[model samples]
Target: MPPTSPALRIEVRGVDATEPAVAPALRFLLRLEADAPIRALTLTTQIRIDATGRGYDEQARERLAELFGPPAAWGRNLSSLLWTQTVTHVPAFTGATTAPVTVPCTYDFDVAAAKYLHGLPDGEVPLRFLFTGTLFYAEEGRLQAAHLPWDTESAFRMPVEVWKELMDRHFPRTAWIRLERDTFDRLYAHRVRHTLLGWDDAVRSLLETSGG
Candidate 1:
């Protein structure tokens, strides 16, 4: 008879931002434990921001108004935000092992997760890491494969400062926004006509002109 697969457990140790590079990213440290030796592990993780798990101050609530509406209506409006989904390969190990799951990040505020993250002024961000994948092990002399249980998951409360630090490392004290080509053309023309020193000057001019 074939042997039954051993149970596995997953835990999130911590999270941090990657060093300055062409693209920004966050690395989540994961610890995997098993009753038996694992030949290899193909891990897939879906990370989510539990927006409703943490309390928000008045300032944060106002900042997040666009996403969750006003604080008065938050009970019905707030929901989890999907941060990212990524896959990683875990090397062979016995008992327990640690691995990093790197998730690429973006400064684009158009993304809901980014918008939600940027809205927070302080405190931790409640995160849920849902794990699913295949595990390979040895039985007798032959190798065996099995699917990780559906219930495999971990919870983490990552400090908002971690994300803010990463962004500050890459962007300094600046923010990014996207504009349509036509809109950009108009803004560029205005900049050139008005001899604006920089993009910020051009945008500030338009905002003042429109009384925004």
Candidate 2:
């Protein structure tokens, strides 16, 4: 007879920003439920943004057009976008257990996930987590291992306010943008020539000069 594998279920409980970290990070609490005793487990999670899971206002549609194209073509353009992947270790547990999954967040506007997150006005961000890995358990008085099934997945609706507040706490009225070295040199020179107190002033002056 084939060995029976343990069926594990995972759920996202909540999300919060980790304090005193060198980089921006969000921690996800995952609750794992299992009927059999799980000696140990390794979980790989693929996080995706379900773009079509929620409604979008006109303003949001306009902002996201660059990513998903025009609202008129949303049926074809909108789809789940891969956000990030993470691996977590689960210790021995019986019945149920919870683990903290720390996911790093990037503020760079060049990232599609970042742009999509920032573009949202207000509402919950629909997220889907695809889980797969290895599971260890005991059966017939002997230890055994089995592949964590691919069909295991979880969905969570994260409040936009949480993301916004996390960014505000870390950046506080500041936005990050990457520019080519030449462009940066030119901007630096302009700031020096104008004796600008900050980069903001230099950019503002250049915009005004160009009638932007």
TM-score of each: 0.96, 0.95
lDDT of each residue in 1-212, candidate 1, tens digit only:
86888789999999888665678898999999999999999999999999989999999999999999988899999999999999999999999999999988888999999998899999999999999999999998779999999989999999999988888988999999999999999999999999999999999999999999
Clashes of each: 0, 0
TM-score of 2: 0.95
Error of 1 at 106 (Å): 0.8
lDDT of 2: 0.93
* Model 1 alpha-carbon drift over 4 Å, by segment: none
lDDT of 1 at 51: 91
Off by over 4 Å in 2: none
Query: Against the true structure, whose lDDT is highest?
Result: 2
Query: Least accurate stretch of 10 residues (summed lDDT) in model 1?
Result: 15-24
